[model samples]
Target chain A: MIEAAKTIPVVRGAFREYYFKQARAVEEPGKIEQREFGYAQFGQAGMTRHLSFNSIKELHAMLVKEVPSDVYCSNAYYKFPTQPMQEKQWLGADLIFDIDGKDLDLPCVPSHTYPVCTNCGHALPPSDEKKEYSCPSCNGKKAERVSIPCSKCIEGSKKEVRRLIEFLTTDLGMQRDNIYVYFSGNNGFHIHIGDSEYVPLDPQARSDIVGYLSGTGLLAESVGVRKGREGNMSFIKFPRGGIAYGWRGRIADKLKIDGSSIIKLKHIVDQKGGYAGFKSELDKMTREMGVRIDPQVTTDVHRIFRMPGTLNSKSGLAKTRCADLESFNPFNDACLLGGNKVNVRVKTHVKLKLKGEAFNISKESAELPAFAAVYLICKGLAEAM
Target chain B: MPVQLMTSNLSSIRMGTGDLAKYPFLNEAGEYLRESGFGWEELDRPDMKDIIDRAAERIEVGVGGNIYDKLEKYEIEILTFIVSLIMVKSIGMEPVLKKYALSEARRAEEFLTQDLKQQSEMQKHSLFAKIFEDLFKLKIEVAEDGRLFKVRVADYLARSSHFHEQEWKLINRLVQGGHVYLDADETVRLVRNELSVLIYEKVKAMTLPTLPQAIKVKAEELRAKLAPRYEYRTSAVTEYPPCVKHAIEVMSKGENLPHSARVMLATYMLAVGKPVDEIVMMFQNAPDFNEKITRYQVEHLAGMKGSRTKYSVPSCEKLRNENLCFATEECNGIINPVQFGRKRK
Candidate 1:
């Protein structure tokens, strides 16, 4: 009976280890205990009495001649093919050059201010007011004047800036603090990444990070890891072996034919590289021979992420920032890339304390916090720190 | 002889010559009779009788023949015709007749008189002809009332008993008074109240007997038959002990029994020292036992603690065996300490 057992090509060792751990945890009184080596040892114990025959031919003969009560069992694994690679850069790059006026000196005063209205058109007094500057002429009944460039000057530049920001932060996984946004002096904005640590990742790693940002990576692997069943969930390990083993166990249970009988039939093969490659071969064999192997196999390999605080881990960072690239425009002098048009007509008042002296910075300051603020904002990093 | 013939012709001519010439007195008699109400009883009055008699006498004198005999023999008919003609004329038949009347006064007069008599006879015949007509109308009204009554009764009875047309008709007849008889609305109210009472009584009387009445009765007889040698246990040992016989009866009767009854029986049997294997075997032999036992096991294991569900029974059993009782683990975990204290005591 042991000699009659069939050999199936699958990553049986890896899956057995995983399933054994799960089965042990659930073993308790008044519950069905998981069988240990039950699939391999069932034939030797003569428990096969419940089963009518050792082979498909014998089973078929029993079914024809006898009461048709014999149960046949067999197991197979599940596997599917991995997608073929197509060469394309997962990372994107965008370069913006200043074409307006002569470049300013290093550490130049970042003062570029325009006074219009924080709300609607009504010239405000030079006094440094609160964050919300209301129109004094209308007594807050009408809108205050906003300081934005005329619409004709900056139309499409802000969108380009926004796209660049999304590609860097959400796609490239670069921290917003690592990004530097600056005005091009004439039209558009330049997004500079001085950090070099993020540049040399492999395509797979880049794709994985992209997948994490888009929230569409390996869900099964993460769940398996959280479940704490070894080999069930792993970022680096192949899952096809375990999936195939589970399929084999299910098929054996369903068919009621022992694995030995399958081995005697000489239909099983020990395919290398786990059960991942066995799925298509098994399907072809089943289709041509009009007989299906009990267990199916899955071959697809996927990359999983170990992001902090996700998948049973504690202390996951919960928040990130996004740059408002819709405000970036390039056609107008006040416009930056990604449709960010400087509000030339709107005035933002800031009080800068420099050298123990408070400078009431109004719309007259040439250096506003637009570049610094935008860089920090786009990378989903903290601002003003 | 020729002279006599000429005189007769002249007399006839004088009698029928003009409106005033032929029976001129008829206009006056007609005017007198027209003032009287035309009811049949009015014809018997002395004044009408006298005018009619005088009219006959004048006709007799004018015609120089037995005109009075003719009038007397057919006076009722003639008078009725004349009254009817006058009534018809008053109601606007005279203008129509006048327009069609012949220019010959004697012939026109004779024709009008004969036509009036015929019209009067036709009216009498018509009254007798349609005597059964009103009977059909009355029957139709009664039938319509019966239909409405039936609908009301049917609606009322349907609320409690199965709706049957014959039963509704019977009830309708049994009840008296139009409001009660055809009182479909009131009947519905009564039916609902009666059904409510019936249902309440049935539910209130429901109980879980340890031994079913049928089995107890049979057991007594069997014990009596064996009384000389052995005695049988007639009472149940467990509170709300399950009665398998009674359960079968309930199920057969098509009534949904409370699930507690089955659980009570199973638990009681188990408490009384029935082995699990024996219980399983017993269930296997029982009708529809597989379904019942499977449901019982699943529910007993899965149901909330203290719930009347089958799952609750197992939890209770577990506690009973351990002699450690607790409402639930979530109740501050007090049961563990209580059990420990009990053990210490």
Candidate 2:
């Protein structure tokens, strides 16, 4: 049975130096984290426990010392008048939306979710549980999520960032200055819409915002009116009267008064078969606009996020900030480690899009940048020497 | 006659520090508010002055927080109207007066539409829908689950009460579809909008409260008639009872009506001989419209299916309980639409 220890061997040795070297503490960490609590997942094993620290320094020291593979803080702030965070005195949390790559439909990207047996290291298909899943190797416990990275889906993830940014800025009217886009170290992006403007937004309000951006219960007629012309010809106009701002204004903008765009808007309103074309466009829009946000992150007020500067053990990269956003490339920009090469014996033909170059890597000993080498090792694709 | 609201009388408006109990809003909360049983009624206006002054002070000293957390749903609706009043009366405060005001306005509208749809779902809701039915004198057959079928006004009642069967049926159909569709004196093609406009229209049209003197100075910029209101499409030249007309306005905006209002509307449509499928088609835009169930129900009411028993419209007394009884020259000993035109032999 391959029962690896909770902490990864060499990876922890490498990550300890990276995490402990830098300090990434949030403002007022004591008040917010003390109430909501936080967690740390070391190496392969899950989080240690729900714990809180006295100051940012305590949290920072733990991160530097432990160098856990993953770290998380509660989204909500807690009340501590008499009782602790475990008690039911949650105040609320800032609204945050997270878009992950696993939710996207990347062409030709294969994914698997299999559990590895602790007894014998035998990973089996979960659907065949009644048969071979009895740990045919050593009668070990069932598998948990390995959360391996899917390297092929990186392109699809970059597109998702574009969709979310457009929706947030154009549709939601979120201030560009207030929006912060971060490459979440591994397989996705995290948008931190901070400030008092969104602080008091309740779960219900957050749900509404999510639903609208995701195209859940959208209506066609509400967006525009089809003005009749000769022989079933029609065009859209601003809602019979002047366009009301906010919801109505947004709808009008989408279904504009342009002549060519009118037919596209009208097919649904007039119950015409031409809606199929519009539907296809909408489907594409859904793919582009569909935000795979972690619901709990936005709803919970006392949630702790990964400190921006910490190295994510999953990909061995820091949760880097998009400084230019338009031109920021995660490969080179997030390469905080020394640019020296490390020899890694990759186990799979892992295709990587990094440093603006495509690398069709097979199971061979190759020297890559230190950050890329760690990426392969952390994604379970290679072993470091 | 359409109520011609005047704005030349700003000095005549009430300026006392009042609570939401007096509004345009609290009454509509109906049973939902009472059952929640949290003493919402006991709460007075949460120092609107402090909020405004606080926002002003914050603007001066740079503070960060939302006052929205302090208020409940009903209170938010009233706050929106109050902020709208301030927006209408003041120009200088406009730049700094937004933020919470805009959000509250949007929330108020959201609650209005939701409150209407939730009326039957909840134990208690406003009887405004019932009021429209009674005022228009529409006879509707109500099923056990509150589904309206065989909607019609008796010939005599339509004649005696002077209720237009076609026009009222149109309005009733709109209500049944969970919309506030009213035919008013204005003219336009169609108004693709929401229910929030109705709150503004109904409140401003019927009850324009004078701003409190302390706040009046900030609100002098907006003339009375130019205040924010829901968008609507008129395109009609028919006379309707003001209350009935109001129903049409709401439906035109495509806002959903309460459950009781739907029953009254369904029965009214059936009585008028509208095709069952056409009747069902009218409700396609309704949030909960089901093609199969709606079709079965409509066909059953038309006597084309079900027990084949033609349902009758509700009587005037039943309509009165819904707050639909807005009687005018049509008021006689007439109990139903059929008795409206019938003479005493």
Candidate 3:
């Protein structure tokens, strides 16, 4: 008979931080110190502290007295009595590119400044009064001047400003005058809602928003691809069940289709330029082949933190300034903060070979290429250019 | 025919321990016996061997008697036909045996005539049916002026009608075991496996919806209550800021720590094994550490120091520690010790 090996106890490092900061109050005469422990309950970070003892000896002694003979040491940790409140205020949003558009630059202040377009590098004038400036290069017709930093050229920066304006006034139900939309000094836009009521949402509620948009919540079950015209088709094909790839290939063969054909369809979906372009081609294919396709495109909102930039802290407002002039890449630098935004850029590309023939396609293909493009985009493996 | 009848009788005889040791041709022994409730001392008399030998010979001759042999042969033929019917039914065939008329009526009449002839022959010799009856517990009687034959046992118990169903199932399981005769241990294992399968089938076939629904509802409620409790922090001192001070305080009490605190203190003691004074000093010197030292605290913490005391500790930490202890010993415990000493070759 084989006897199982004895388990050894594992020790983990534990530490926590308590924040103590004094903030000035307008109504009160003096500043008040706000001290709170950073630890939250239920998370690995929060629970670690509860298990820590002054010394390892104490922990071992406890183990000897209370633990059952069969249970292993590494399985136990610090258990807290109460559930931790989730931290909410930190919400994430995405700015997706629905259609390929020109690269735009937004204004950034120095120290917090980001790169601006070399073609129309202009800063918003510093003043309490709101004013608009037109881009001289765009002949004032194409570009509207706004009092915000433009990291891209001044002409292109107008689009981001317009988008922020529309989002604040319409999507978020915020008054245009009260909302402060700023150039994140990169590719995307950031809107700060100063409403105190929206500051601290419980972590679960914050997670719910993330879960909802990510299609991971209870509501996600009902949210499925709508049945469109009978002839419409989706290029991407998902597996029916947990069958292996080899089994799937066999099944596909039995269905009178080869793996290559399915792959080619996926390629076409991902290469399609836009959702409309993908649908039209899919409809055409369905009409000709008598097969229906239901295309589904899902967006995932990933949470991110705002990194340090060139904006000057003393200004207390967003300004047009240049920072990091030496090295700038919008793809790497621009990070979207929390909240709702649409039309994010996703790149999807694939190589298809059929009948001793190989073709490389981008998102611009109209037929099978477009379906593959959309498929890639939907799976998040690639993005539309 | 007589030789075949004798051979059949000899084959059917099941040997007893005493009779088995007596015959030079043990396999040809005609008389058989199961374990009787008789002690060895009762057979110690000088005449016991002769009596037993004579009994065995008489049994052999009686079973070989022409009438007994004829009836046994006919019984075997009928039993073979019955078994074939059962086998065909088992193979998904519709059974028509119940509707068929008796096909061997002439053979049955011949069997009756042979039994009467053999009875007369035995009566002529000083041997009688009484001797055979007493030995085999089987009765032989002629009925309807010797036109029909009947055999019966006064004390023999016939198996229940459902016996075949159970026996067939057991036979199938035993076949899966790859053996004809199952030892007691193997039989027990087979029995347990069959029981488990039976229970699962019974449970699955239950039509009552409320039973499963109630179980599921209770499980969900328990999960909701336990989910929060299951969520645990790693090491208290390192993971949570508030827990550091609490940990220090618990450790300062040493053996005198509270039930919960004792678990924490014992964990610390096992890790560093610091003296009471040293433990007190470490807590005092540490920033934000707020534990007061007491002799009772040291005693409380000490209770969880050894192997035996570890089990009494309630904290998960203690449980895990015990597991580690057992693991370090190569999992050798009172319940499951390493067997066969097949060390890593």
Best by lDDT: 2
Misplaced by over 4 Å in model 2 are A1-7, A24-37, A81-88, A111-155, A225-271, A274-296, A300-303, A337-345, A349-373, B1-345
RMSD (Cα, Å) of candidate 3? 33.1
For each candidate in turn, the TM-score is 0.13, 0.46, 0.18
If both were scored by TM-score, which would come out higher, candidate 1 or candidate 3? Answer: 3
Off by more than 4 A, model 3:
A1-154, A183-189, A202-385, B1-345
Instruction: Please state the i-RMS of candidate 3.
Output: 30.8
Give the range of the ten consecutive residues with the poorest summed lDDT in model 3 chain A. A10-19
Worst 10 residues of 2 chain B by lDDT: B184-193
Better of 1 and 3 by DockQ: 3
Give DockQ per model, in order.
0.00, 0.02, 0.01
Cα lDDT computed for each candidate against the true fold: 0.28, 0.48, 0.27
User: iRMSD per model?
Assistant: 37.6, 17.4, 30.8
10 residues in a row with least lDDT, candidate 3 chain B: B153-162
Using DockQ as the measure, the top candidate is: 2
Candidate 1 stretches greater than 4 Å from native: A1-136, A139-349, A352-358, A361-385, B1-345
Candidate 1 residue-wise lDDT, A1-385, digit = tens: 1111221101122123222332232111111111011112212333222121223343233323331111212111112111111221123211111111112111212232223332333344333333554455554543322122223332333344444455445423456676655443223344444444433333222222222222221222211112224432212222222222222222334334343443321222232222322333433332322111110010011211111111000100111112444453322222111222222212245433221233354543233233222221221111122
